[model samples]
Target chain A: MDTKIKTNNTTSEKIHSSENIDEQMLERLFRQFSQEIPDDGFTDRVMKSIAAVSQEESVSQKTAFSLKAQIPLLKSLNWFTAILSVAIFLFAGGPQLVWNSVFAPIFSNVTSILPVSVFRWTFDDWLVAFFRQAHQLYSIDVLTTPLPTIYILLAVLTALAARRLALLTV
Target chain B: MPSVTDIALVLQVVTIGSQRAFATLVERHQEPVRRFLRSLTNGDEALADDLAQETFIRAWQGLRSFRGSASFRTWVMRIAYHTFLDEVRKSKPTETLDSNQRIEPNATQTDNFMLRHDVQQALDSLSEIERTCITLQLIEGQSIADIATISGLPQNTVKSHLMRGKQHLTTYLRNHGYKD
Candidate 1:
């Protein structure tokens, strides 16, 4: 009976010791395996690649932002708002004829009032040259005849047709 | 806290187009990323290095989008994991192991080499997801939340994967005559 008890205790202790050994073995194995990884300029190569990529992206983003900034309409919220307000006025007024008539005159007046040095010519000189050139190029009646009205009417009709077609397809 | 501040400074420098800052970030994270990728790829050092490079490249491209919601390490690890998975998917399907074949030894007899070989072979036999879970949890020593973030899985799913991986490893070890 004592022998049987001793055998069972020995077996249990052996099993316990074996478990401990295995755990230790696993820990050691992990350490050795980790040490096998090469640190040979791997990080340096990665950093070089990252630096190249970052430089490329930064250049592209700066270029894009600078381009966007150069556009007066996109440079400031106030400019966008002003343009949007003008668009809203054009849309709400419902006088397509008035828009066509007023557009050229407003543009002409604004350009005329700006400093003559902007064009490298006096305003009067530019106006005289422009009208003289126009007279030399075409009949006065033909130059004065408005074409944007017809173009705008065609654009509106084409857009409505496109919308209808898109809706039908959907 | 110092590391956090350093990362923040590097981020600021990166934002202002500092190549040095980007290099610093890559240098700092490369080891962890390589370690994680090595485990995921089953000790393929070359593949891990390639994937690590790709991760840094992707991170550089997407740096502007990082919102500081998670640690940069977690974010970069997540990128590396996805890049690895993408490569895995694009490559041929993973070779399936025969159930009847015995696990092969990978290390020598000297100085616990057998133990290392057995552990590595057992790890190789596990499914990719299982390997990733085990690597993140045991090898990389990432927290559960960080593992979830890196694995892009829910926390519960990550836990399940870790549990299943451990169970599989235990069975493999026992079958290989390991007593633990």
Candidate 2:
């Protein structure tokens, strides 16, 4: 192993010494005859290209920044719409109005079309019974109902937060 | 005006996007960069200048990535080398004979031009990697490590190329009337 190491060292030294000789010869050749390229207008051309590149970069950056800047305004608009919808819904008696005008009528109509002879009640009477039951099921107190105002508002807020998070991830 | 260092110029260009500072850097290094390209292109002055211009432009665009490990000159030479390789890859195979035939010597230096012509001919005797290693080491005065970095070759490979390139160059120049 020692002998192999010594052999490698000697070989490397030989290569290095010969490499030095070649370097000297090359130096002589270049020192005597190497040309210096004159800069007639190269710098001007490069600077012009650089200016164009810089202009392109800045323009793109500005466009990206403007797009980013509009996000807050969009977010504010979304919040305003959400809040206004909730406010209009609550001011119109919330769940009670939804039950009376929307869900209760649908339930009453569905029952009115079904057979009502099983209980000796007329179709209209059955519909009236279903209407009262649905109204009670949905409840009259907006804040205390099954689908409470607070629960709906919380759901809306959670949805908005989730949407914002999705957009950010994108 | 006091001459600033390349590092200072580089700092100004990076921090402030100073075109004037970058222009100064281009002017300072253009000679060596152009000469290196001219050698690699085998004396095609027009192509050499075009490649050199591209090298500086790329350097400017990527100035922020310069880590100050190598001198600005070595870094730019690396860029010039890669730009030359990219051009070569994009084009047909190199016609050194045609390129040599295209060389128009400067009128003022007939004897030196003749010597340079002979040198270019001798350089033609080497393969591409050998010639690049030789040019980077001898003409551009880069170290073996620097050549490795510039060529993206290992140090041992660069050393081998240098050894072989030196032997070929010496034999060619010697046969062509360059006495020891």
Predicted candidate 2 versus true structure: per-residue lDDT over B1-180, tens digit per residue: 437999999999989889999999898889989988888888788888889988998999898999999889889999999999998888876553355577566777687778888888777778888988888877778898888988899998898888878888888888888865
Model 1 chain A poorest 10 in a row by lDDT: A73-82
- Model 1 Cα lDDT, one tens digit per residue, A34-135: 644455787678767766666787799999887666554333434335444444544454344454466545655766787544344443344346555766
Residue A26, model 2: Cα distance from true site in angstroms: 2.7
Q: Could you tell me the TM-score of candidate 1?
A: 0.59
**What would the per-residue lDDT of candidate 2 be over residues A56-145, giving only the tens digit for each residue?**
999999998887776664555465566566556654556456566676666666667874443444443443565456558986343344
What is each candidate's DockQ, to 2 decimals? 0.15, 0.32
Candidate 2 DockQ vs. native: 0.32
Candidate 1 local lDDT, residue A144: 54
Candidate 1 residues B6-96, lDDT tens each? 4675577556866667666776777888988877776666677898999988887788777778888889999999999888878765432
Clashes of 2: 0
Query: What TM-score does chain A reach in every model?
Result: 0.32, 0.40
Predicted model with the maximum lDDT: 2
